[model samples]
Target: MKGRLFAPRLVLLHLVFLAAVVASGWLGWWQWERAHEAGGSFQNLGYALQWPLFGGFALFLWYQVVRMVNGTELHRQGESITVPSATGHSESAGEDATERTTGGARRRSPVPPPAPPVTEEEDPELAEYNRYLAELNAAARSR
Candidate 1:
């Protein structure tokens, strides 16, 4: 525990946590002073109360980080989580489309393939545009 706490990265984190707490406390103090001034409003007082809570929250987050680094954080067990696949099948099912292996990698999503390109014969507007372009080309060649 002590070793983890004194690690270089953790030491940096501890300094950051201290800075955050001290800054928050200083901000709270500034807000409190502003709240007591002649031009002060209730908003300043609200902020004065809120800044200390922010400092406390920072302390809580720092503690959680330390706990996580130390691997002492509690984790829930005996819970089976079911993830849904792109093909509308849950992982709990016997067959998952996402789990279908292709050279050890998962298969792609089951989206339909793109439609083939439309031919001018299949589209009257496209055929009309092509006829107009042909006429313009022939006129240009004559000129």
Candidate 2:
């Protein structure tokens, strides 16, 4: 399978994401109204905005997940995942890509050596441990 998104699993996943988005949005709306109806303090107002923003983020995440699963990349603008850098400028995904590319191909990590064959001589410690554990279990059962 080429992993296309017209399958049963994708349908189930879409349902889950949709439910999450709806639930978060409702919670956010409830919080906002609660703040308004209550004392109307700065803290309450901040909570109101924060909850709505969380709801918005959940919705956006759902959209992105669906798009990616359906063989499409996320189309975003000014979405810089900022790392705290000494320089004021932030690095981007594209910049990382360019930095890592060597010639026309990405560098391949060196393959590790094949593992040695198993031997029975190395297992005496495990056998002793098992015997100790069996002794403890037997003692506990007798008690």
Candidate 3:
């Protein structure tokens, strides 16, 4: 863990984070000074307060990165985190794609699968239109 923290890439990251925090603090201080000056406005005071929050957020992100690198995040504690699939069912539930059970009620997709393609003989006009579009696309691509 200590070795990982001091790795070359991590060292660079640490320096960057330190620079961000320092820069934010310096900006906040500058804004605070501006707010007290004769020409200062409420906007300067707002910025003075906002800069510290940015520094605090940077600190939070840095700490989270360190924790993730150390494999100490909550998700790494052998706890299963089930994400819902696009069909609105927990992926880990092992339910069939055609149907799924949610809250003791079976649910299926309201939208049906698309119908098979229509052959040229079945719809000659549509097929001709499609061929025309394809020709136009090919012409555009050649240019």
Tell me, by TM-score, which candidate is best.
3
lDDT of 2 by residue, 13-105 (tens): 768767777776777677677777855666766776776677677678777876676433221222334343334676543433322343443
Query: What's the CA error at residue 122 for candidate 3, in Å?
Result: 42
Q: Lowest lDDT 10-mer window, candidate 3?
A: 72-81
Candidate ranking under lDDT, highest first, comes to: 3, 1, 2
Models, CA RMSD each: 12.0, 14.5, 10.9
TM-score of each: 0.49, 0.40, 0.51
Candidate number that wins on lDDT, 2 or 3: 3
**Cα lDDT tens digits for candidate 1, 42-130:** 99999999999999999999988977865531212112336675557776422332344444534434763444455677897976777
Clashing pairs in 1: none
Which 10 successive residues of model 2 have the least lDDT summed? 71-80
Supply candidate 3's per-residue lDDT for 5.
84
Q: Quick one: best lDDT, which candidate?
A: 3
What is residue 119's positional error in candidate 3, in angstroms?
37
Model 2 residue 36 lDDT score = 77
Candidate 3 Cα errors over 4 Å, as ranges: 72-143
Model 3 residue pairs with clashes: none
Q: What are the runs in model 1 whose C-alpha is more than 4 Å off? A: 72-143
The residue ranges of model 2 lying beyond 4 angstroms of the native Cα positions read 1-3, 72-143
